[model samples]
Target: MNKIFETPLYPYTHHPDEDAETPVRHKTIVVGAGPVGLAVAIDLAQQGVPVVVLDENDKVSFGSRAICFSKRTLEIADRLGIGQKLVDRGVVWNLGKVFKGDEKVYEFNLLPEQGHKRPAFINLQQYYFEDDLVARVRELQEQGAPIELRGGCKVTEIDDCGDYVALEIETPDDTYDIEAEWLIACDGAGSPIRSMMGLDFVGRVFEDNFLIADVIMHADFPTERWFWFDPPFNPGQSALLHKQPDGVWRIDLQLGWDIDKAEEKKPENVIPRLKQMLGEDAKFELEWVSIYTFQCRRMEKFRHGRVLFAGDAAHQVSPFGARGANSGIQDAENLAWKLALVLEDKAPDSLLDSYSDERVHGADENILNSTRSTDFITPKSQISRTFRDAALALAGKAEFARPLVNSGRLSVPCAYDGSTLNGPDTDALPARTRVGAPAVDTPLGQGWLLDRLGGRFQLLTVDADAPDRLDVGGIEVERVAVSAAGNETLRERYLGDAASGVYLLRPDQHVAARWTSFDETAVRAAVAKATGRDK
Candidate 1:
């Protein structure tokens, strides 16, 4: 037998005291070495910002913590330089089936509508996930990417004094002090920095608890998401099953706040539960086990002066939808470019405020969805459970009741509707690629539209040349021209029935503005608004 999740642990290194003559001040300091922290550090380093990352642990997460990687997260990983590795090393699945007792309720697919580059989702363990990110960051480090990953380093104190944020970090042997113009808190749900500032998260905590087990065995499980409410094997409780890479199956059993937490986690207690579901003949090895309660909460604002929060530090949702890690990755993507532009003096500092506004809006959406899923799965009151049971009963036979049945909504990219940074969208345009939406991935002649856009401010032109007369406060913008001869999706998304179209895209591949014709004035105005120069 082979261990599919193999990764080398990082080494613990010492941090020297700051030289009195010339202290090495970093532009950005990121806390934690998890996927979200590594991602934000990588994004900042790619944009030529020197970053220092601190982590108490010396390796990737040990277990299959977050197994679901949504499409938006993979796309962001693609831009950060590790999309293919994540795709190639994970189990891909799109179809999901939901059931009640012994009867099948319904099934669904996430990527039913085609025309995108990435799949709907992939199942991967968190250990391999962060390991791959660390490898990529090391590869870039060799090429002059100033990303300093200090494993076994813990942040003891954070001193925020408006102009700059100072950190007192301790290593295994010694302690040192450092300073950065900006600090990104990716330290996770129990954020130390967030605590130091007396910041509180306001949200609901469900009474139900869940037992998650990663079992390694050769079984007849299909490569799909199977969820059951009041299943035959585990009567009166819910269960979820998914196939991950390397023959490891993730099983989550909803034990509604009544079982002994310590006893259920024991192999003696867990194996019998498995026998009821898989029968006595099914041989399996228990790889890992954990018990957790659900809580959906987030900081009111992501930014506090020079310090900003990303990933789990900023918000936290229940594991039902897999929104925890995926949304955290998007937070890094959303803040990195804005921070880089502001640091380089290309944009006003107020541009970072938009990062807070937009991502706060995104966190709210994730929390809302996660709360609804948690409520549906583990209803609090008798009336709520009655409504849930009725919906599940109707879902097995009635087509109209399918929407009411919620196992888990899964995760999706957030469309930032009503964002202040959003510019004009021509009337009667396709709503899919409208302002405040993620730029639709269109298939070009031989590549994808996102590949051509790169990581800069790109002006996507359909049936029009790059605007030569456009100038937005000396901001550098790249123009990519698309033709209708081979690229129909681009025109359909941006131009609609119009003859030509021009779209200004943010550095993060989000649609800023679009118009029926190529107007240099409109493009520049959008740039001004996006960069916070106009507003």
Candidate 2:
């Protein structure tokens, strides 16, 4: 248990606005200073939008929550200027092993290919992640970024006034009012803001619970995700293990719905279970312990008037796939650019509707996968369990059954396949970089391709003729020209069999459109379609 988790990073302080004649309005206000909130705030501030963040607490998360950071999330973090710090301080792993009743069934490599800079996943405690984000905020503030974080400031009431959102915030010593031209709610799963607005999630809540134990120990377990179904120690149940930074290991034990959660979390009962799995003599100290239920749900709509929701406030999923935090980060990234554009008058307010549409699609994708993983992990009926066991047994001997074995489908980037923002596409280029999909990373010059994209709308040309820059309506699209002549990986990823390719990328690095060759008229229309102008 690091002291950083309890230390106040952003203690409450008096502000001039508290004594103002009226509510001091800001261009943007973010509620809840968690990872997603901080991420979006940083994004907006970097884009020169003055944003304020309000949080009731002043410290990082208390436990080893959200231990897995996906590769796509790391790329987004790179744009936020915090990617390398997370990678440097996290456990990098790409291999996963599954077992059935003490026998290893099969293994999988998440990222088998080369040329990508980031690993498939990194295991770091959520507290460490938040601490680094707060540090990044401080660094950005030092560099004169227009971002403010107010701790111990709990937003008690939210009033959506069509044009702006009025908020009532409570501090330790006083209460005050403020207004925001646009509001972003990144609160937790049990979001008070969402409750205040009388909104609710609509999805499944599985009747099962999982115990998470963050144990500090010196173990020889390889740095890979290991999952066991009906292991000896936890008979008739499933378990998961993974290495984290600072000699910590995260263990998850599935407990059927009937058990008492509080008793299961007790060390008196938890230690014996650990001893059974670790041979009675293992030396370990419990750093954190908690029980969680599987819930795959999301709000009907993420946007309401001028207030928008991101992260757990908008959607939630089972922990098995590591989609919770990762998807939330994606939500933040998606909304930040759109909100920024709308506020700057570069795009219409209808552009924000695409945020809701795209993220709801993402949430539904995560929910579907998470629900399937939960069902497979915890079969409701005996026949379902029998089928799962059969799949597990066959996975040990046959390659085809391996795909049926669901040790929890690991998190992957959600491609907005049919988003309205997606522009024209050609079958000539690679499908991996197709319209609405994220731009695949490849080696470029001495660096990586993603490092150059960096949260900007750009024209990616692979040996294709395009202008140095183009002003589509009011938005600037810079040209990034790279020849695919000597770059096989780049050609394979971007050009494929096509002689040349041109791509229009959104600020989030998603392919808005692609063409075999650049056409000025078509490019302008694509930009209009992407910005919600055409609609």
Candidate 3:
């Protein structure tokens, strides 16, 4: 086991609330100390919301559960002040190779273009990811941000008392009751909070399992994503190889639905399989091993009265696309700013409804793609297998068939196209920067566009005239002006053929509205609309 997992980062501590005469209410409470929960707490604390994070455990996660972090996730982490740490301690890769039988089919690049500050993806252990987030929380604590992480605090019961949520938490020494104006649950896939609320997931659980093994070995494999379909060693099944930090390599091997999971997990069985895959002389030590089944499901709604759900507690998808943790982190980012505004009374409580609406939209997109990838990878029937095999075979010889080959359609940021918060959009501007899409990064004179627009409602104007700042219904929108004359990337990404463009960006850095020219009335209406005050 790694030292990170052995040491308790947030050990159990007695709270004054435990001995209080009555339950003490807090502004916000986050259940679970995972990436999503910590992220939500950090964002809220930075925004001046007093938050308490309770988790059942003390140390970081034991294994490298979610090793692949996408660029969009990195960008969001950058806003949280820990993106560079992840990139620095991760194996960055954008290239992926697919294989059929013993032959290499084709390769693809996730981010072939440049001007973005981060890479397409990075491979780091989940433990490292959580460690960095917890460290960030400590930094915020030192700076007097109102955030507290309490470990060994298990939530035994929950009650949604109309305007607030009451919780029963068990600590090592004693149990206590607490209340919160709002509660955010990030308790992972098997969420007790969801169960206590009598809520359940609705979707498909495929009849297949995959054996994941994280082995520490010095290998000569290139730093890239290598996925194999019906490889020689793992015949009639699929395999995936990914490189991680600290000589750790993740290997996933398909295990048919009907197999002894316990027996297969034995070292006697697992070692031979790895030897067959990595050759007889390949030496390695097993760091972690687990078996996972495929399930693409989500709650009916993320928000349930006073308690809101984010991350695995709200939605789940097949891990083939690396959408699990990435989507969860994105959920935190989407909900944080909205929840902050609602708590501060800057926006109506109805604004939080859009959080559920928009995130459910994102969850559905991930589920759809994840289901398709699962079908292509597993192939329920012979006909489906035949079609998949044909696609892979033709993918090498034909350019058009390459798109048909699905070795897990990699994760991407979901654009809220039909979101109610989306305002007007101009077709003359670049479609990538249109309404409801995530703002694409462009290099400015000294820093990046995303860095300047960090975690706030801002007006991005390129070769357009707008006031330095605008007060729209109590929301401040600062203008970031840049010329597109010499910046070709900015011109192509934001301006296109249009001479100038003005964009209203949400605090999450998503475009709420865009136009070829600036209009104060239009911008004010957009701010109102994006904040859920349009009605």
What's model 1's TM-score? 0.96
User: Residue 199 of candidate 3: its Cα lDDT?
Assistant: 99
**Per-model TM-score on C-alpha atoms:** 0.96, 0.99, 0.99
Using lDDT, give the best candidate's number: 3
- Write the number of the candidate with greater TM-score, choosing between 1 and 2: 2
Off-target runs (Cα >4 Å) in candidate 3 are none
Of 2 and 3, the candidate ahead on lDDT is: 3
lDDT of every predicted structure (CA atoms):
0.86, 0.93, 0.94
Give the clashing pairs for model 3: none
Error of 2 at 216 (Å): 0.6
